[model samples]
Each structure stands twice: as structure tokens, then as C-alpha cells.
Target: MSTTNEAALSLAGVDKIYALNSRKPVHAVQALDLDVRKGEIVALLGSSGCGKTSTLRMIAGFESVTRGSITLAGRRIETLAPARRGVAMAFEGYSLYPPLTVRDNIAFALKSARINATEVDKAVKEMAALVEIESILDRYPTSISGGQQQRASLARALVRPADLYLLDEPMGQLEPRLRALLRGRLKRLLNERGMTSIFVTHDQTEANALADRVAVMEGGVLQQMANQTELKERPANLYVATFIGEPPMNVFDAKVEIGERVRFIVKDGPALDFSATAFSQAARVAIARRARAVIGVRPHDIRLGAGDNAAKVVSNQWLGDQSHLALDVAGKLMVAVAFDQVNASRGEIMRYEVSSTKLHVFDADSGEAVSHGAEAA
Candidate 1:
């Protein structure tokens, strides 16, 4: 990670509000503060209407900031025109010129910068090949497929020289295999050139595969910003804890009681009792202060076939590589994943165990994380 002095782009207290006629104003982005270091690849991840796209547009100068300051390469650019912001953006809509061929579209920026004709052609060809669009270089926008058009649009933006690059759903139109292939190539290109970039995507796989860090957004608010591992193992709050992981984290309302043994009494369910030494002093104190809390555990952490607790298997599915089991544990639904295929049938009784080391505790009222594993969060 780079220091603040080495930041390539910075946003401070940025907000975007759209006032409709005779309707309440919509807050698309809210007091967002972000920093992108030189050569760092950051992914803005969120579901639809989560403001990830709005944040990208605001940074690219395509959307006006209702409030806040944007600085790029030491210059304030919030009020600047899109063309004057030194930022290049690839739109999700494939905004290629209908009359221009793919080659011409990719070479437009170079030509506008007064590069020689030979150099422009060379650059265009290289970019087209990089994006697997070399075969469609002579085709016009209307003559190409959506995926081809998307590649051409991406090549057009990536071929340009800019201080920062913003991509909105860059490969949304490609098939799964092609998307995965391009993800590697794109990461290599960005790293080789040391280009600072921010991309918007709803796919967690894309974000995890491409970005050095991910900024998660929800309801126009920044939830958390961290690398994939941190977001998974040490999420900032309940929203991120549940949102970042696949199958999500399973949470249950519980009452904490610390004594010779630490016990979490599930609401109208079972009691998960553990040794007091399983948690650190800080974690014990935090849990003791809250009478009621939420306890979470990942599906992968639940071990089947050996424990005191009994559960009824609701459904079991073999996903070719792993087994996904839905269980009714103490009257609550819980999902567990196992690497090996189990021969258990629906309605069969099974034993499961979750160690205290795999447990996560959060505040019941605010949904804020208190501890992860045996340590304080």
C-alpha cells in the first residue's frame, strides 16, 4: 500500500443528489472519501443501486458533485469538464461512434494527441489484440456483436494516455471463460504500465481476481475498503460481514454469559458453550458488556459428523466438488459446506461442531462487529 503523499487520486466529502420534480431528492452518493495510490488497481463493488457506478461517474467528471472536492495528480478537478480532467473512462453502454470502425475508434485518442499515422496504427493494433478485438478492427459499431463492441470500447479507452482510468462494468458482456481470460490480461497490463485505475463491478469474483483492494458500497454509503482477505476474515461491520462472503455468513441472535465457561444462548434455541480460555481478555470483556449479541460463523467452518449438537439435514447437494448441506439446527436454518460428498439423506440426523476460534461476534443493536475468532475486531 502507498502512503497518502503518493496518492494519484483523492475524493473528499463527495456527494451526489438528484432532485426530481415534486419528489424527494435521491442521494446517489454520500460523503464519500477515497484515495487511489499510483499504480494501484481498486474495484468498486456493490449490488444494483448501491452507488458504485455513481461514484465512478463522479470521479470521471461525467456527473456533477453536489458537494465535495476531487483532486487528481495534485489538481482540483471537481468543477472541470470531462475532457479536461485527465481521466479516461470506458462506459458500460459501449458508447462507440456508429460511423467509426473499431480500429479508428481505438486510435482516435492517439490521433487527437498528434501522434504520427504509423504510430497510431501500431498502437491501435496492439490494443485491439490485447482485448481480442483484432479480428473486428475494420467493423463498424453497428456491424459488431455486443461482446465485440464491448471489447472495442474497452480498447478505445485503455489505448489512451491518461492520469487515471475508470471502467464501468468493463467486461459485462463477455462469456464466463472469456471474462476470466481477460481479467488476467487486464491485470498484467495495468501492473506493467503502473496505471492507477478504478473499476465498477457487481461480481465478487471479478473484484477478487482483478483488484488489489476493493471498496464495498451499499445504499450510497461506503461500507468498507480493504483487500479480499481482510474483507473476508475481518469485515468492518454486519453489512460487510454478510455481503463479502459467498453463501453469506450465518448469524444468530444470542445472549452472552461469561463465567467458568463462556456460553452463547441462542434465542429460543441451543446454547453454544465454550471454555473461557478460548477468547482473549479483550474479547471476553467486549462480549460480557453486551447482554445480547449476534454470533456468526461461515459455512466452511461448520464441521459435520462429530459433535455433541445434533441437527436434521433439510437438503444435501453434491456440487461435483463439494457438498452443500442445509440443516435445521435447534429450529434455526443453517447452511454448511463440506469438501467431501456425504451419503446423508434429507431428514437424517447429523452431528456438527463449530469451534470458538471460528466464531464472530457482533453488537445486536448496531450490528457492529465486536470480535472475530478469539481476538477483538
Candidate 2:
């Protein structure tokens, strides 16, 4: 909440709907509302075609909204030309003029701001150094590495006297390690300059690492907005819960009376609530609501107990740091995480243990979480 207005850029009830040649209409962004506070990084995240790009473009003044308004530092800019929006943008496609040197390109923004030539030179030099492109400042865009060229493109965006910075999949084409490295550096640059930014990315991990808050969208509709902890632990809806975590949230179904404590019953498997009273009053109220509420527990929080590896581990997706185990239980899926010695094989029955507090409960009908006790009650 603090971040939105503090954000240099914001979209207040912004809407974008497209009407094809003669067919029906497709809503690109549905009454979307968001704020990218000054000095804060907000990530607009969603699957492909889920409006993440559309939303970013609108803020950059690249796309016009069919309805709703756009505001930057309290001034409306929805109908303004992209060049007059006072917003800097770095997107997947390079907008750099190939003939210009890195220094010249970085100075382009300052020139447009009516800054004097002397000051433009100083700002361009500073921005070039910040993005590690100073060495290539004199080189033509065609001569630089893709990464360096992109860095220059980014530096150019930063040189501008804009209220907000919009990054639309700016790292989309970079290698993984480089992407990770740039993400940290880019975030630092924004902070050092005290600039507000709205970053769009489909990678949840990236969003988690870079943003002060993340906004999740699906089918042109925003699902939720929150910090990393809230997004991962207290997702408002099932999609947010499932979309934010890596190896994802291990889930199972159970039904119990309110105030009753019971580990989800697994046929011949270790109980998630295997340790009695280790559970909580809220969890009981949660399970009873569903007649079968889904129990979601993160992988790292679970383990194959002693004799716990007895249940058959039917499916496993190994990804270096951890392995995702999918065990079959009474014709349902029971996922778990094994850290140290992952010696179990597929269909090899294994035992598991889950922390009571770590278990997440969700409504069966709405797919939203039945968390916070009151909802469960």
C-alpha cells in the first residue's frame, strides 16, 4: 500500500480492451489498478498473454487504454504521447539507433529533457559507468556485445529525466546467470537513482527477487498483490499459491471437524500432521470447511522420515538444489521434498514429515485460501 503512491508511476483503474476487425472483443487488461511507488520496484507478473506486457506498454505510453486513466506523480498521462509521458522504458526489442555510439545514445534522453550539452555529457558518463558500459561509450552499438548493447540501452533509459522506469522483459533474451546478475545490478541502479519502476516478468523467482511487491494476473484480471511472504504463504487464491513457489507447494486433501486435529490420512504413508498437537487450532478449522480442504506445504519444509521413505515415491523431478517427489496415495497425489540423501526410487514407498504451521489450507469451491482462522470459522 505504501509502495503504490510512493511509486513514481501508477495505473488507477486502467483498462485495455481490443476490438478485432469484425469479431468479438478481447479484454487485454481488465480494470487493472496498480501503483509503482517512488524508489520501489513493482513486478507485473502473469503467464504469456495474461496482460503483463500489455500493462507495461500502457504505462510506457506505447499502447493506449480503451478506458481508465494513467497517473505519474499525480499527473494524468493516459492520453499523452509516449515521448511526453516523462517515463523511461527498456523493453525486449532494442530501441537504440544502430549508428549512435553508447555515449551519444545514453545522452539522447538528457538532450530531449533540454539539459545543456555540458550536463548531458556528465549524465551520460555517469549512467554509462553505472551500467558497466562506460568502456564501450565510444563504440558503435553494432560493435558491442549483446549484453553490453542492452546495458547501454538500459543506461540510455536511465539517463532520461523521467518520473518512472518501465522494464518490459528487458532481460528476456539474456542467459540465466547473466539474467540473475543483471537483475541485481538493475535493481541497485534504480535504488541508487531513487527511481520508481514497474518491471514485468513471467518468472516468479525473478519477481520474488527483484520486486518490493508482485501483482499476479490471469485472463486479463489481477489475482492478487502482496510482498514475497504474503504472495507465497498467504496467497489470496489457489493460482497465486501454486504460481509463486519453486518445486511448488506440496499439497494433499483432508477433512476434519472444526477444532479437531488430524494429519491428512495417507494410505500407508507418513502423516503431514504426523506429530499430534504439533498442529494448530486454525488448521483444524481450515480442513473442516472443505469437507476436504487442500493442504499445501512447501517442499523444503517436508522430509522423508526414518522409515518415512517407505511409501512409493511415484514421480520425481530433480532440479539440482532439490527434488520434487510425487507419491501416490489412495489414488491421489502427495508431493514432498527430500533434501540430503535422495536415495528413494520412483514408486518406492517413503515416509514424510511436515511442519504444522507450514501447512496451507485452501477452499475447495473458490480455490482461495481458507487461512487466517476467521475464514475457516
TM-scores, in order shown?
A: 0.96, 0.85
How high is the lDDT of residue 257 in model 2?
Answer: 40
The residue-by-residue lDDT of candidate 1 on 87-163, one tens digit each, is 88898999999989888889988899999999898889888888898888998999999999999989989998999
- The TM-score of predicted model 2 comes to 0.85
Candidate 2, residue 344: the lDDT equals 72
- Candidate 2 global Cα RMSD: 3.6
Clashes of 2: 19
Off by over 4 Å in 2: 1-7, 20-22, 142-145, 252-259, 262-287, 306-310, 315-326, 330-335, 372-377
lDDT of 2 by residue, 1-377 (tens): 13434546667787888883448788889988886677888888989999989988888778888889888887899999997888888866767888788788888777766889999988888777766676788899888778777778777877786788888776776678877887788778777767788888898878988888899999898999889988876888777877878767756555534433454553444344434355455555455545656667776766565533345678877768777777776565767776655777776767765555666777766777876222341
